[model samples]
Target: MILTFFDQFAIPHLLGFPLIIPAMLIPLTFFPTTNRLAQNRLSTLISYTSKTITKQLMLPLSQKAHKWTNPLFSLMLMLTMLNLFGLLPYTFTPTTQLSINMALALPMWLMTVLTGLRTQTTTSLGHMLPEGTPTPLIPMLIVIETISLFIRPLALGVRLTANLTAGHLLIQLISTATLTLFPMSYTLTALLGTVLILLTLLEIAVAMIQAYVFVLLLSLYLQENI
Candidate 1:
């Protein structure tokens, strides 16, 4: 049997952020021109499985800003698939691993910085400081914004890693205890098992939300600097 290193609070790094490379590639697999077109078709099938709904039920386009959201949505979908895949019995959730999240977030943070710098505005860093402040206050706000900027990546890493880790561990503990302590009377254990399965689905949703949150904030920050 493959051993899990963490009962809880295990360092998430040794899991190898290798998860990122696969996450990045999942969307590319959907490109029809690629050799992975079969995977792409399968993804589309799963994504649009509510075939009972006709075109009449669909809503019209609201705004061009919608295009900006595609990359974020794609990332979310990929991570959600990864999360769901890990929900299989005896599997591990890479989304629960900190190293994977940090790997994802650090690139986003750097991209924000690079995009902001490339689109330099006359406003300068000075303008981002609060208005009508003393010279000392100026440095303070700059320092605060700078720190906040860095915190974006940290928050992204913590949010995904912690949520996934906690959810998986809770499910594991409940399932294990059920098997061990209530071996004979299995109804309650079965109910709890069902609840845990539902929670894994919820975790998949949460992973998508986190991806959108990361990209939306990063874009907003870049817009401001631009």
Candidate 2:
């Protein structure tokens, strides 16, 4: 099926609200703390679903949040799935849209900030502040930090949106230019189409790069605070 921003949310919402946001574990509900010990016991006792639910029901929300390690990884996977599958001719790339990127980035920014606060490293907030200066620098740093913090998500959202949107549009524009010059020039069309095909491959690589950038920065932010 063709991918669109609405399709991303609509399909999941139709199924279950829980599916909209990424889950830490895929088949296994909560992450196993000790490893295969619980998995081995659970497997021998009853069905996997039964085991998963029982394990999940027993845990508190705080505990569950602590176990979540790969949130940015999950977001990257979702975005990758949307872009790769939708790259087929007429399908839309939701990654190319600001709305979708904002949705992804906004939550990430909030999570980053909240994580910093919870981890009790408020001094790490000084990254947005200046290095060394006089008393007058305090006001300047406050304004600068405020701007910097807001820009984090905005920059993240726009970078991917603009790159993907521009790349795809460029390919389309090139093909359209050729068509205008020689409407029936099968040779020119074939050559340009090959270029577009190559670009599509490049776009797949870019998808991975985008994911790495997002996740790496996320990890870096956590490391700084922790």
Provide the TM-score for each candidate, comma-separated.
Answer: 0.66, 0.63
Off by over 4 Å in 2: 1-68, 128-131, 178-187
Least accurate 10 contiguous residues by lDDT in model 1:
52-61
The whole-model lDDT of each prediction reads 0.60, 0.61
lDDT of 1 by residue, 116-160 (tens): 566564454554576788886787788887787678888888887
lDDT of 2: 0.61
TM-score for predicted model 1 compared with the true structure: 0.66
**What is the Å distance of residue 193 in model 2 from its true position?**
3.2
Candidate 2 lDDT over 134-197, as tens digits, reads 7878888888878887788888888877777666666666656666656778798778878877
